[model samples]
Target: MKYLAAYLLLTAGGKANPTDADIKSLLSSVGVEAEDERVSALVASLKEKNIDEVIAEGKEKLASVPTGGAAAAGGAAAGGAAGAEEAKEEAKEEEKEESDEDMGFGLFD
Candidate 1:
């Protein structure tokens, strides 16, 4: 990820093709150590590609991914049912308590 970020940063800075040495230098400037193998791999992968087009392709691929909203909604529905039961029991307890204290006097009062 760091290697990718460095490559992207150089590309954004008008370096049409950032070399491995450039990536390492940029990382060192920010107190980060760039791994040579990873830097080389990233540079090679992006060497002949347009960064903008690559990013657009990645976005399209990511858009097709499932975000688990359906699973979360189902879990929430199940939890809501259990919560409703607990609320009903609490309501019954409150009703009994209220009946015994109709004069509206509380411990703090």
Candidate 2:
């Protein structure tokens, strides 16, 4: 991830295609030690690709992904019975507390 960030920083700074040295230098400038293997891998993976196009493609792919509660809440809200069960449990707990208080037992006693 650090390697990727350095690469993007160089690209944003007008280095259309950042080299391994450039990535390592940029990372070192901010007190980060760059791993040679990871830097090389990142450069190789992004060789000959346009960053802007890649980001645009990523955005398009993400746009189709579900990012709302509907999909996540489907299973939890199934049968619509959780609310009733939760209410019953809450009532039982309240009754237990009231009975305990009615016993007139104090911690100091």
| Best-fitting candidate, scored by TM-score | 2
lDDT of predicted model 2: 0.88
Which segments of model 1 are wrong by more than 4 Å? 74-109
**Ten-residue segment with the worst summed lDDT in candidate 1?**
100-109
Candidate 1 residue 53 Cα shift, in angstroms, is 0.6
lDDT of each: 0.89, 0.88
Clashing pairs in 2: none
Per-residue lDDT of candidate 2, residues 1-106 (tens digit): 8899889989999999999999989999999998899899889989999999989999999999888777657855773688668878999999787664676785
TM per candidate: 0.67, 0.72
TM-score, cand. 2: 0.72
Q: Give per-residue lDDT, candidate 1, residue 73.
A: 88
